[model samples]
Target: FADPSQAYDEQEASQEEERDGQYFEPVVPLPDLVDVSTGEENEQVLFSHRAKLYRYDKDLSQWKERGIGDLKILQHYETKSSNCAQTIGSLPI
Candidate 1:
């Protein structure tokens, strides 16, 4: 009887070679994108720190974690107003 495992191995090797020989082109060529402004371009970062944020939950009666992010304090050049910016990773708790 033909070995089933050997057949599978040969099939896998053929598939790998087929994949290596294949050349795929994108259906639609993507154009280069211009940089988008975040409205803080005129501001300068005064301080930046990585912090974990938490919020008090009334129903759960405990502090739930908000997220871990880089907290930045920025000062505008003209207005000299300080603005806080946070970049968080993970889902909201």
Candidate 2:
């Protein structure tokens, strides 16, 4: 009788080959020009620190951990207006 294990291996190999044969084209063509805008491009970071934030709960009479993120103080180049931001990755928290 044919080795059951060998048959299973052959079947798996054929399935992998079938998967490799399939091709997918992009539904939409890539743009020639792409602008990488992060909104903070115009601004300059005055300060950046990795910190953990907390809030005091009056009802619970305890401190609650808000989140841990990069705390940044940004200042605009032209306007010179400064602001603080707590962000996790590229997102504001």
Candidate 3:
């Protein structure tokens, strides 16, 4: 009998490989946690992984991680307004 955990691991590895191929490295570090909100005042795209939330800094031309304590995100949603973009996430307290 095939081990369920092993099967799950293999499946996850295959999915990771597929994701890696689709998303170029260095550009998107964490694709699953990355999202874009497009509206009028440009788009607010962000990325997050584990406890760190990252935003693109135009002046620095780099992705900067925000230090907001140990944040455990259950889910995240990006909302766009006429002139702004917002990202809302469910974090465990």
Candidate 4:
């Protein structure tokens, strides 16, 4: 038997050609880390370099920022990498 992913690859290719070059773009949004941990008054902040725990708030529909007083700077980096084995590919799974 051939490699298992070969058939899967062929199927994907066929689908791609049939669509006349339109492709599915992954809709990965920036994780909006919302933290009012430094209290509700301070809108501007410099985050600690070591802070890592994140809290998600369902009611407010955002993440509550922690380690506010400890952070030195806020840097936003948007990076993408896929671990196919762990990916929930073609969702509606």
- Residue pairs with backbone atoms closer than 3 Å in model 2 (clashes): none
TM-score of 2: 0.58
Return the TM-score for each candidate structure. 0.58, 0.58, 0.25, 0.24
C-alpha root-mean-square deviation, each candidate = 7.0, 6.0, 20.2, 17.2
lDDT of 1 by residue, 1-93 (tens): 999999999999999998997889999999999898777789999999998888999998999998899888999999999988788863322
Candidate 1 matches the true fold with a TM-score of 0.58
**Per-residue lDDT tens digits of candidate 2, residues 1-93?**
999999999999999999997999999999799797867887999999999888999999999998889998999999999988897655687
State in Å the error of residue 86, model 1.
Answer: 1.0
Candidate scoring better on TM-score of 1 and 4? 1
Compare the candidates by lDDT and give the number of the best one: 2
Residue 32, model 4: lDDT of 83
Q: How many backbone collisions does model 4 have? A: 7
In candidate 3, stretches whose alpha carbon ends up further than 4 angstroms from where it belongs are 24-93
Cα lDDT listed for each candidate: 0.87, 0.90, 0.52, 0.46
* Cα lDDT tens digits for candidate 3, 1-93: 999999999999999988885754596565576565432234333433335557899999999875443332222234443222234343322
Cα lDDT of model 4 by residue, 1-93, tens digit: 888799999999998889996768779977788764522132322343433345799999998753222223332233222111111222211
| Candidate 4 local lDDT, residue 7 | 90
| Cα displacement (Å) at residue 51, model 3 | 31
- Stretches of candidate 2 off by over 4 Å are 1-36
